[model samples]
Target: MKKTESISFQDFMNESYKKVKRRSRPYRTFSFVPFSPFAMLDPTILTIGGIVLGVVLIERFLERLGVLDIVDKISSVMRFLFPLTFFGAIIYFLVTF
Candidate 1:
């Protein structure tokens, strides 16, 4: 049988550290969006909804100020209709209550 060489503690630690560094994977980042009404809902869906709402509001504001021109009439109409429908639903709910 061949005699095995023993590794010094410092050398063993360095080798282990190097192996760990080589095997390390990149960390993943996640965005958190806080929605009070939907606390029980999935965080990913909440984040996506918040992002979409922010984009829609920004685009509508820019369009209103003539800073952004939307080429699609259907998109423009849908944007306008969404807010109106939302407010109308709120009013209807309030009136029913």
Candidate 2:
């Protein structure tokens, strides 16, 4: 009888493994100091995070008052009418110029 399934062979089985060969990093020899004390130095990330937080809080507040759906409807209508208004403004600009 022949074996239907055979065990897999590993690539490292032919080579001897090194016990300690991975401590060549530059930080091992040099002292490292961060330029900024804070983890994140850029304030733009904080500003954007604040805007996102504000939007989420306001959306939740509107949803709790049952006004989020109404706001969505108004936004959709405004989106649909945006192109027409944009074209009207372009035409007015061209005529007045």
Candidate 3:
């Protein structure tokens, strides 16, 4: 086995300070989201976010166009489902495990 050089405590600390990460672009941050990739990323979360985004965009567009008063019906359904979704997901996880 090859012998490795041991770093002094002071040398290790100095080396850590010297190493800098250069950012190629500005960081994107979202509220209530963590800076970690693994913490922020989950396939289920991504799918849910995408679905919500599309729904909101479509609703807004339809509202602006004054296509119909369909949003009221959707809002009613949302009010009922919102709470159920939160509680149901927790129950689903519990049952799955």
Best by lDDT: 3
Candidate 1: which stretches are off by over 4 Å?
1-40, 70-97
Residues 1-97, candidate 2: write the lDDT tens digits: 9867433355246444333477765654444662344534346444545655665576667778989787686557656665665565446544543
lDDT of 1 by residue, 1-97 (tens): 9987677799887785344435668998765642344443545445655765876787777678776456255467768876776666556544543
Angstrom error at residue 74, model 2: 11
For model 2 the local lDDT of residue 29 reads 43
Rank order (by lDDT, best first): 3, 1, 2
Poorest 10 consecutive residues of model 3 by lDDT? Answer: 33-42
Task: List, residue by residue over 4-51, the lDDT tens digit for candidate 3.
Answer: 777679978779645679879988877774245564355665566677
Model 3, which residues run further than 4 Å from truth?
A: 1-37, 86-97
